[model samples]
Target: MSASRTERLLNLLIALLNTKYGLRRSELRQKVYHDTTSSEVAFGRMFERDKGELRAYGFDVETVTDKGWGSDDPATTRYRIGKESNRLPDVSLTPAECTVLILAAQLWEQAALGSAARNAVRKLQAAGGLVDPELPPGVQPRIRPAGQAFEDLVDAIHSQHPVTFSYLAGSTGQEEERTVEPWGLGSRFGQWYLVGHDRARSDKRFFRLSRFTSAVVVLEHQTFAPPSSFNVREQLAALPELPVRYAVVDVAAGALLGLRKHARAGGDADDTGAATPVPDCVDRLRVPYRDAETLAEELASYGPKAVVVAPPALHAAVRRRLAAAAAFAAAPFPPIDFPRSGPAKRTRKRTSEDQLKRMLQLVPFLVHNQGLHISEVAQRFGITRKELEDDLRILICSGLPEGYPDDLLDIRWDDDHVYIIQDLDLNRPVRFTVDEACALLTGLEALNGLPGLAEGGALESVTLKLMAAAGEEGLKAAAVAGPDVAPEDSAVLETAREAIRGGAQLRLSYLAPQRDAVSDRDVDPHRLYSLDSTWYLEAYCHSAQGLRNFRLDRIQSLQPNGRPVSSAVDPAGGFPVKLFTPNDDDAVVVLELTRQGAGLADDYYAERTAALPGGNHLAEVRFGSADWLPMFVAQHGGSVRILQPANLADATREWLDAALARYEDSTARQLD
Candidate 1:
């Protein structure tokens, strides 16, 4: 960095300390830039340079000492900026982009702490010296992980090795030996589990981490060794996240699906001549953005086109997730009398009626274009290059969960001047297609139907997209936006969330399906969560007197009427599947199969059976999941089942029984 830039970096630190954390000079350097080692050889005068740069950037830092206490300690010096920090970034952003960054920081704050998150608080805190850093008091503890074990598992997933731990069965109270070569870890509802090959058991398995006594890295530095012929996600995505489809997606000609798709390699059926041509129907079709939200959005896209043809087991799983998600979203929430409208007045006085030109001038870049320069951004913004280095510091701090989560303001200033990352047509209007409006309405409607307590969350995300599609008028349009709301139900959920966080006891009306009656009770709501699109309050139900599932849809009303308790709340657990599939005689129900499903059966699930009976038409298969028998059958489509007992057949029949009933019920309703 140049001498001037270096000096500005120091001043930036001083301004940061004075405004945000209230740091004193000598102590501030020790916290961030100072070397902790006692050795002096590697030291530099970072502190002195920082002080000199602060003055040059037009920041006046005053040093003060309180004279009293012990006479010896009277000689202390602390820094407080004259009138906030002068270090702002030179780059510019439209008010909307700046708004998104702020919302992202707020919405993503907690996720950033997750090991899976690429951005984090410590990172933002280090660079956002000139921008505002405080989150509104109401928005603490952003989005809570459904469970902590899932969080820890996600943290460990980016590694290659066998996870060692003691796992106990919830009912049997028996612990077993397990050494799993983890492939991937995923979360559902409120728990986390790992999918990998287990050398100890000689099979592929899914084990929940929350049920373990201890979780540790027993070994490290293992080869990723994805089976030369498999697709992992397609195999594991059997339930909640997406529909496991069988229609042959056109794999590139001559390209083999990665073998790692199987847990480990089920059999020699991982094959060739039987390979079919990649169909032209889906030949590199357009896919939506590959961001996290895309995964959730899939539920809407794959609704009826992707059918679970044969295995009754897979069918139930899909229905349950959707029904559960729908049931959850359509449920009731705690009541609140949210005001009928938004803020009645702007926080600031209306400066002028000059329209677009005036709003553009308010943009940081346009207001200060003279001093903006690529190299001198540090000097003009009064921030260190590193602070304003990556993204615009002004935009970095602009989100509000305190308001709607997605309200966006594109504020950018770059190169020590106001420069936007992308141009937004503030001068033009936005028009939406009928389909886009339908999609937008559908998403908003989903929010409107959410568990009463969390209904607002869904709407907030919808409003954000709407504003983005609304074009030029933006905030001016937000002022006129309206949809009548019955605030009573939503009020309850908010109060419940508040009580849960504040440690307050709640009085509520709960309906239990098993009993089919609503009862009044007092309980402690430990956490609030949404899974499969429905909202739920996880708590120690004093009525059940144990950790129980209370659907938000069934909740009638609620309020914080009791004191917060001091006890800790245990995290949610996963649904267990007791079945297995192995690659050899050692497993149950062996079958010769097509080369298609071999990688999944052999490699990951360890259910690979022996070689094809004739090495010409089929491959072998084995797997274990007592509940999955029918679902497994459905997934294989028309594939042959070599070992079928009266029980497995009866199981498939049973699922059809339930499904046919549901189908019949729909028909009856339509006829009415």
Candidate 2:
């Protein structure tokens, strides 16, 4: 049965138990499936199935048959799951089994595992086992799943129903409609995939959840019986493996640390397994990859730091993307338009899964750490105090069904500390699920590849222990494919990290690309963050006498400044300075835009658009520097015109003339 239907059944059971007499079929249907009322025969069948499932799951559903019991009715049947049969007896789980349950719950932190993990946790809790859902600090792994489609598909799978949706196949990059009977779902390499018998294709196929482009609608009255011999893992293993080829690449020193695990395995190795270290700041390494295009994209992102030395296809793919990028820079582009006609939609609230996770973690936390400051708990859970309070309010009424005052969770707070009156016996930390363990192992491997962590470091040891726990199947389930940090860049990152950690300053030889120069500066390193595969350091520059953001790649050298950060400069006081912001040095220019160019109003000047006659628009555009204004206007290809600041317009015209002359001259040269 579907999880929703099972939930309804449980609610019906509770309602039946709450009454002195069993509820008739009509009463049960009205009370339980109120929103989904159906035909009499359909309701009877569903109710009967629900009762049978309850019995199968160890609940005794009692049926009272009445033969005109002092009334004018011919016959009547009423049903109830008695409390003695419905309520779970004492659950005595071993510590190891409890740990497994905890680990299973913790698996939900990853997006792909979240919904199923949450359902599992709730079921366990409902079964009267209070589970501690929190894992040890520093064990979190970043994992993103297939979002809403995953949850919907999980429901379809559980109900043995067919689901219809549009799926975008990666191989073709085209969306096609499909109806499938979902047999199972699995995660591999941090990606969720659904396996099912495709109705259109008449064959079982695997679909990546990420490819789902439309809502998964479960067929109302259609269901299928899964084969008794069906094995999800077996099917996944039987899926065809793509052809793999080895590529020999020249890697820069200290870069490609993540690939060192495959070190000396295939290349530059003698009879002994020791790797031959090629010198001259470049190492010849053999790397195996299945997808050439993917590998090319990854290698190209590294730019000059790494080069593909052999296998012409891989190199060509990288060069192709680079050439396309160059062509785009010299080409005129279409204006981007965003739809803005509809009324603003309400922001979605956190999912019930998120609420359940927080509650599961929050309860045990409060139970173990009684009298903890409410503010501290909120901070610990990475939620606002108001959100924390809202969760508490929700929990106040949550407990066993037919919720009596004694059955509900007892929560008490005195504006400062929070206390839980009842102990749920869920105070142990969650262990790691196989997939989660694999994900964390992958992260730890990347960390261990770094020089700072390679030499018997804590992270390295953790990696070893986790590998031991993961066993063979877990190791094969996921992989870590992170960017290769050049040794120099890694060292710079480490230095900045230490400065941030120790509250010290850093002396950096930084390259300013826009200024076409390199300069020395002392900066109080604040934090390090990665975006678009590039690491940046946010710091207070002593030379600039202001906060500045420095790309780690642009830092030629970095060293400690031998002084602690000043107390006056709070490391966390300021917000991130945007790359483009209104400043005293910037110019506010008015632009007259055609319909095509005006479409960009929301993007460029959402708050400064004014409609003009003849379907034109006037936008107030701010420029940090007018150096690129001419090129930017040229890129718009006459869709825009400068309306104010005559000097700026005249300068832009001259720049355009110069650019035209250069292009004309280049064309003439080519012709000659």
Best by TM-score: 2
Give one digit per residue, the lDDT tens place, for model 1 in 262-318: 112112111221322222322211122222122222322233222222123333333
Per-residue CA lDDT of model 2 for 1-672, tens digit only, reads 443553465455446555556777766666566746577778767777877755654456777767646332313777765555532233444433454344333323433444334443433344445445333211212223334566566567655789989886656655799999887765533345688889898998888664565567789599997665454556666666668777666666756554443443335542234444443777777778776655765555444445554455665554544443333233432333323442121112465445544565577567767888999888766567888888787666544444467755688887678988853232322333333443344334333243333443544444454445445424443321222222335667777777877878788987764353679998887766442224677777788676677888788789987998863553443222233444577787767665444544433433355556665666667776676565456544445666557687776666555444433432353345
After superposition, the stretches of candidate 2 with alpha carbons farther than 4 Å from their true spots are 1-349, 372-387, 402-404, 414-416, 423-439, 464-480, 484-507, 524-537, 557-567, 573-672
Model 1, runs deviating above 4 Å: 1-152, 168-174, 201-203, 221-236, 240-554, 557-672
Error of model 1, residue 562, in angstroms = 25
Clashes within 3 Å, all models in order: 89, 1
TM-score of candidate 1 relative to the true fold: 0.27
RMSD of 2: 12.8
C-alpha positional error of residue 642 in candidate 1 after TM-score superposition, expressed in Å: 54
Give the backbone clash total of model 2: 1
- TM-score for each model: 0.27, 0.45
